[model samples]
Every structure is written in structure tokens, then in C-alpha cells.
Target: MKYTVLSLFPEIIDAYFASSIMAKAVSRGIVEYRPVNIRDFALDKHKTCDDAPYGGGAGMLMLPEPLGRALESAGARQRFVESAGAGSAGRSSGRVIYLSPGGRPFTQDVAVELSREAELILLCGRYEGIDQRIIDTYVDDEISVGDYVLSSGEVAALALIDATYRLVDRVITAESLEEESFSGGLLEYPQYTRPEIYDTLRVPELLLSGHHENIRRWRLRKRVEKTLALRPDLIRRGEEIGLFDGETRKLIQELGGEG
Candidate 1:
């Protein structure tokens, strides 16, 4: 998938795309990224991109003109015009996303859905945020990484890119994706490494037994136990949505009884 990010600080987005797993993904052509500097589109001598809100606000808001031009440069179109049967001349087809605290919550499910897209256009707002007209005309979705507020939109954008990119085809193995926390409606089971004994603790006996079936059962039980203790909401949601099988439900009942 290709990501076209519009940010005032392209360096922040560039650094992430050049490091670690993302660098490898780019090298293999499994993903691509383009960071467009929003300030570059500013027309004024000072290249100012923010201004005080018309109705009064705590902080300045990002000006719409520069941001709108930046979005157009990244191949975004006014949705109202598009809906009115405007031609697609010079426009790139991609989902336009705005990162904001007021947006829909970002989740594993949302990441999975975005991974299927051929291209994505991400707008990283600054100051108070980009003008609402920009959102109404160009954005397809607004996503929040979490419930909390953040000062920098670039941080939120990077969080989103990291989550979705790893799920892309060939970026990582399918097995690696499986059994992850939230994949099976429960947190992942604890893992152990070599040196079976560590400061008086030993690897689980079932794991050392080399009995695959028994090991799988043990892991499932641990997963249930961990989720119930840490995030029982997941268990309840799973049950409500019928995400668990008979065996899993039985385990939850047994564990709940023990508790």
C-alpha cells in the first residue's frame, strides 16, 4: 500500500519510514510513502499556516488555504465536487484520513480494513487543527489513536501508519499476525524464551513436554486467564458476539468460578 502524508514537519514522517521494519518493507516494495510538507504550500512571505480562530479560541487554528492546496497536491478532491459528478482528472484515488481527537477510535479491526486499501492519504494537522472546511471537502475518515489528547498530529499519524503497515501482505508472515492480542478477541498468552529456568522460575511443564495439543490447550487457558484479569471487557464482548467456541466458553466459566 502507498501512503501520502501531508505534514508541516516532513522530517518526522520521513524518519519513521526510514527506520526498522518500515525501512525493510519499503526496500521490498511491500509499501511506499510520500511526505508532503504542508508549509511548502503556504503563499505568504512568512509562509504562515496558522491563524487565530474567527470566534476566539485558546490556540491558533491551521489555515485552510495552505492545507487545502497541500491536499490537492497529494491528489485529494473536494468530496462535494466529486459527488456532483466532477471529473477525476489529475486526481489520485486514495482514502483521505484526518487525525483528530474527535475522530472515531482506531482499533485492530480498523487497521485490518485499511491494510486492504491500495493507497491512503493522511493529513497531520497542527496548531488547534486544520480548518473544518478542509475536513468537509477532502477527508474520508477521521481516526483517533486513543481517547487521550495529543499536541502533535504527526505522532498520531505515525502510530496509525505503524499499526496498518505491519498488517500489509508480505510485510510480515500470516502466522505472526495470528494469535496476536485482539486477533482472537483476547490478549495474547505470555511467551517464554530459552534458559528454561530464570531466577527460580521455570518454563511451563507442558511447553517443555513437546506435546503440541497439550501446549496449545495450556496457552489458550493462559490467554483466557490474562484477558479476564486485565481486560474482562474483551471476554464479555466476545461472548456477546459469539466469538468464542464451546471449549473457550467452558474455560471462561471454569476460570470465572475459580476467581
Candidate 2:
């Protein structure tokens, strides 16, 4: 996968791509991170890119001109190109996704969808927000990480990248990916490592037994338990989607249908 991030603060997201799993992915040619500074496209010597809102607002609105140049220069007309085919998350159309608080809630499903794209152009709006014309003319979708607001779109863009990039080919192993939190429509079970006994507490005997079936069952039950306790909403969603199996149903019943 290839990522093109348009941000006034390119440095904010650039350092992240240069380290950790992302860096390794880049080294292996699994993905590429291209951050385009919007300021560079500013026509003025002072590089002004924002101005006061027309009807009056608390903050400035990003200008349409520099943004137009940046988006156009980033292959806005190509719409994914013959080589890429950057499908719309998973649909037929290619897209430029803008990160904003008003957008649809982003989820694991969205991450899974975006993993298939050949290229992704992420727009990180600053000041109040980008001009609506730019969005109407060039953007394909808007995504929000949550209901809360942030200082700008750059932080949210990093979050979206972090979630989706791991799903890209070879960025992580299938088994590892499958075991992560939210993979099974529930939070992951607790994890353990060395120091079988820590702070006078010993690792679970079942984990030490090396019984794969028992361990798997234990993990599943723990997943259910944790979801019930911390995020019953996920359990409700799982039920609505029929994600739970007979065993999970039995487990919930065993717990008296309570968290």
C-alpha cells in the first residue's frame, strides 16, 4: 500500500513512519509513506494558507487555492491510476479521505476495507477546516476516529494509518493479526510473559499446562468476560451481528447474562 498524507505539519506524521513496524514495512517494500506539506504549495511568499471564515467563525478556514494545488499535484485527476487502482476503501471508486469530527465513525471494518486499497490519499485539515469546495471537488470520504474533537486532522490521520497499516500484506503475520483486540468483535484476552510469578502473583496454571484446547477455551471465555465488563456495547454489537457462537452463548448464559 502507498499513503499520501497532505498536512500543514508533515513532520508530525513523518517521524512515525520512520520507526517501528511501519519502518520495517517500508524497508520490505510493503508500503510507502508520502507526506506533502500544504504550505509548500502556497502561492504567497509568506506561505499563507488560511483565512477568516466568511459568515464569521471561531477559527480560520483553510484557503482553496493552495489546497487545490496540493490535491491536484497529488494525482487528484488520476483517481487511483492504472497501476494502483486504489479502490474506494473497497468499492470501485478511488478516494481522498478527509479526517474530521463530523465524519462517519471509523471502525475495524473500515481498517479491513482500506487495507485492500492500492493507494490512500489522506487529507489532514487544519485551522477550522478545509474549504467545502475542496472536499466536494476532490475528497471521496470523511472519517472520524471518535465523537471527540482534536486540535487538527493530523493526529487522527496517524491513528487511521496505525490501524490500517498492520492489516497490509506482511506488515504483520496472519495469526498475530487475528489475535489482536477487536479482531473477534471483542477485546483481546489478557496477556502474560516471563516471570511466571510477579509481585507474588503467579501466571495462570492453565497457561503453564501447555494444553492448547484448554488455553483456547480460556482465552475465549476471558474475551467474553472482558467485553462484558469493560465494553458490553461490543457484546451487544456481536449479538446483533450474530458474531457469537454456541459456546459464547453458553458462556454468557453461564455468567447469568450479566456483565
Candidate 3:
């Protein structure tokens, strides 16, 4: 998948794309990233992209003109302007996303949904936030990384990109994704590495036994127990939506959960 990110500080986004597994993904052509500097679209000598809100606000808001131009440069078409024949070359393809605290919550499910898209254009707002007109004209989705406010939109954008890029095909193995937390409506079971004895702790006996069926059963029970204790909501939601299989439901019930 391709990600076109618009940010006043492209360096932040660029650094992430150049590091670790993300860098490897890019090298293998499994992922593509373009960080567009929003300030580059500013018309003024000072490159001003923010201004005080018209109705009075605590902080300045990002100006619409520069952001609009930035989005257009990233292949996003303004809803009304497209009819006037001013759309960019790939205007109809990329899904434009804005990072905002007021947007829909960004969850594992949402990441899975976005991972299926061929291209994404992420707008990283600054100051108080981007002008509403920019959202109204060009954005397809507004995603919130969390409930609390953030000092920089790039941070939120990076979080989103990290969650999504790893899920793309060939970025990571399907087995890794399948066993991860939230994959089956439950958190992952605790893992152990080599040196079975660490301090006073030892690897689970079942894991050392090399019994695949027994080990799998042990992991499933632990997953259900952990979810019930830490996040019963996941179990409730899974049961309500019939997301769990008979074995999982039996595990939940045996673990003293409603299932």
C-alpha cells in the first residue's frame, strides 16, 4: 500500500519510514511512503500556515489554502472543485484521511480496514487544527489515535501508519498477525524466550513438553483468563457479535466469564 502524508514537518514522518521493519518493507516494495511538506505550499515569504480563528479560539488554526494545496499535491480532489475540472491526476483513487481528536476512534479493526486500501493520503494538522473547509472538501475519513489531545498531529499520524503498515501483505507473516492481540477478540498469551529459567521463573511446563495440542489449549485458556481479567469488554463484545467459536466460548465459560 502507498501512504501520502502531508505534514508541516515531513522529517518526522520520513524518519519512521526509514527505520526498522518499515525500511525493510519499503526496500522490498511492499510499502510506499511519501511525506509532503505542507509548508512548501504556503504562498507567503514567512511560510505561514496557521491563523487565528475567525470566531476567537485559544490557539491558531491551520489555514485552509495551504492545506488544500498540500492535499491536492498528494492526489486528493476537493469534492466541489473536481466538477470544475481542477482535480489532480490520481484524484479519484487515494482515500484522504485527517488526524484529529474529534474523529472516529482508531482501533485494530480500523487499521485492518485501512490496510486493504491501495492508497491513503494522511493530513497531519497543526496549531489548533486544520480548517473545517479542508476536511469538508477533501477528506474521506478522520481518525483519532486516542481520546486525549496531542501536541503534534504527526505523532498521531505515525501511530496510525505503524499500526497499518505492519498489516500489509508481505510486510509480516500471516501467522504473526493471526496470533497477535485483538486478532481473535482477546489479548495475546504471555510469551517466553530461551534460557527457560530466568531469575526464579521458568517457562511453562506445557510449552517445554512439545505437545502441540496441550500447548495450544494452555495458550487459549490463558488468553481467555487474561482478557476476562484485563478487558472483559472484549469478551462481551465478541460474544454479542458471535465472534468466538464453540471452543473459545467454552473456555470463557470455564474461566468464570459470561461468554
Candidate 4:
């Protein structure tokens, strides 16, 4: 899929696009990135994109004009479809997401939802934030990566891209996505490789045992145990959503947990 990052700091986002899976994806044309500098669309000689906030604020607010015009001229929808090898999705009405502190909390489900879209434009807010006019005019959704604030949205945008891109068809193995954390409504069980023994701790015996059935049972138990101990909320929510089977229900009861 095509990812258009509207940022004042395009360099920060560009640096990451050149390496690892993203780099390879770009080369293969499986995914593409276009980082538009908000300032590039500025009309004045200074090419300014921010100004002191009206009504009094500590930091400057990004202007609406440059960002809006940049998104319009850059053909946000066209680039995103071509990047994903999906061809041009006419008029790219997919999603225009704004990254901000007050946005809806992001989740694995959200990532999965976004991966299905043909195109996405992420607005990276800076300083205090972007002008409200920009958000009202173009934003499809507002999403926050986490509770705490970061210095810039560039990092958040990269993270969102990595999570969403890997879910695209052929970007990574389907089985790999299936095994990742949160894939099954529970965290993944521990994985081990190479040296059988690390320091004094050995790999779990069940993982090494040749009995596939027994190993599967062991992994399921561990996944339930770990989720119960660390993220009981997930289990509760999972059960509410009809994700738990009789076997899993019995397991939870055996562990002195409800639902």
C-alpha cells in the first residue's frame, strides 16, 4: 500500500524508509513511501509552515494551508495504491489519519483494519499541533499510538507503517503474522533458538519434545497462563467476544480465574 507521510521533518521519516524490510519493500515495489515536506507547499519567500498559536499558547501551531495543499497536490491516493502494487485507486478516498495525543487509542485490530485500505495519508502534527481547519477538512480518523506523548509524530508514523505494511499480502509470510503477538487474542508464547542452553536456563522441554500434540498443548497453556498473569484484561475481553472455547474456559477455571 502507498503511505504518504505529511511531516515538517521528512528527513526523519526518510531515514527509516531506506533500511530493513521497508527498504526491500520499496525496491520490490510492494510498498512505497512519499514524505511530503509541509514547507514545500508554503507560498511565501520564507516558506514558513508554523506560527505562534492564537489565543496564547506555549508552542507554535502548524499552518493549515501548506499541509492541505501538499496533500491535495501530492495525489495522496494514487501514490499509496501504486506502492502496494494495487494500481491506481481512483481518487484515493481511503483514510486521512491524523496522529495526535487526543486521538483514538491504536490497537492491533486497528492496524489490521488499516492494512485493508488501498491508500492512507498520515498527518504528523508538530509543535502544539496542527490548525483545526486542516483536521476538519481532511481527516478521516485520529489515532494515537500510545498514552504518553512523543517529541514528534515521525516516530509514531514509522511504527504505524511497519505494523500495517507487514500485514499486506506477500509483505511477509502469512504464518508469521499468525504467530505474532495479539494474533490470537493472547500474547505469543516464548520462542527459543540456536543454543539449547542459555546461561543456566534451558529451553522449555516441551518445545524440544518430538510429540507435536503435547507441544501444542504446552504452548496453549503457557499462552493462557501468561495472559492471565500479565494481561487479564485481554482474557476478559476475549471471552466477551466469544473467542474462548470450552477447553480454554476450563483452563481459566483451573487457574482460579473467572471467564
Clash counts per candidate, in order, are 0, 0, 0, 2
Please provide, for model 3 over 142-255, each residue's C-alpha lDDT reduced to its tens digit, 9 standing for 90 to 100. Answer: 999999999899999999999999999999898899878998899999999999999999998889998999999999888999999999999999999999999999999888
In angstroms, give how far residue 231 of model 1 lies from its true place.
0.9
lDDT to native, each model: 0.90, 0.86, 0.91, 0.83
Find the candidate with the highest TM-score and give its number: 3
Stretches of model 1 off by over 4 angstroms after superposition: 82-92, 257-259
Model 4: per-residue Cα lDDT over 1-259, one tens digit each: 8888988889998988898888988899988888888888998999999889889959899887888798786664333333555654455454788898889988999999999987788889888889987776667789999998987988888878888998999887888877567867887877899699999999888788889999877777878888899989988898889887888788888887786
What is candidate 2's local distance difference test score? Answer: 0.86
Scored against the true structure, residue 1 in model 3 reaches a CA lDDT of 97
lDDT of 1: 0.90
TM-score of each: 0.94, 0.92, 0.95, 0.91
* lDDT measured at residue 79 in model 1 versus the true structure, 0 to 100: 74
State in Å the error of residue 40, model 4. 0.5
Winner on TM-score (2 vs 4): 2
Best-to-worst TM-score order: 3, 1, 2, 4
Q: Any residue pairs clashing in model 4, and if so which?
A: 1-84, 2-80
What C-alpha lDDT, on a 0 to 100 scale, does residue 54 get in candidate 1? 89
In model 2, the clashing pairs are none
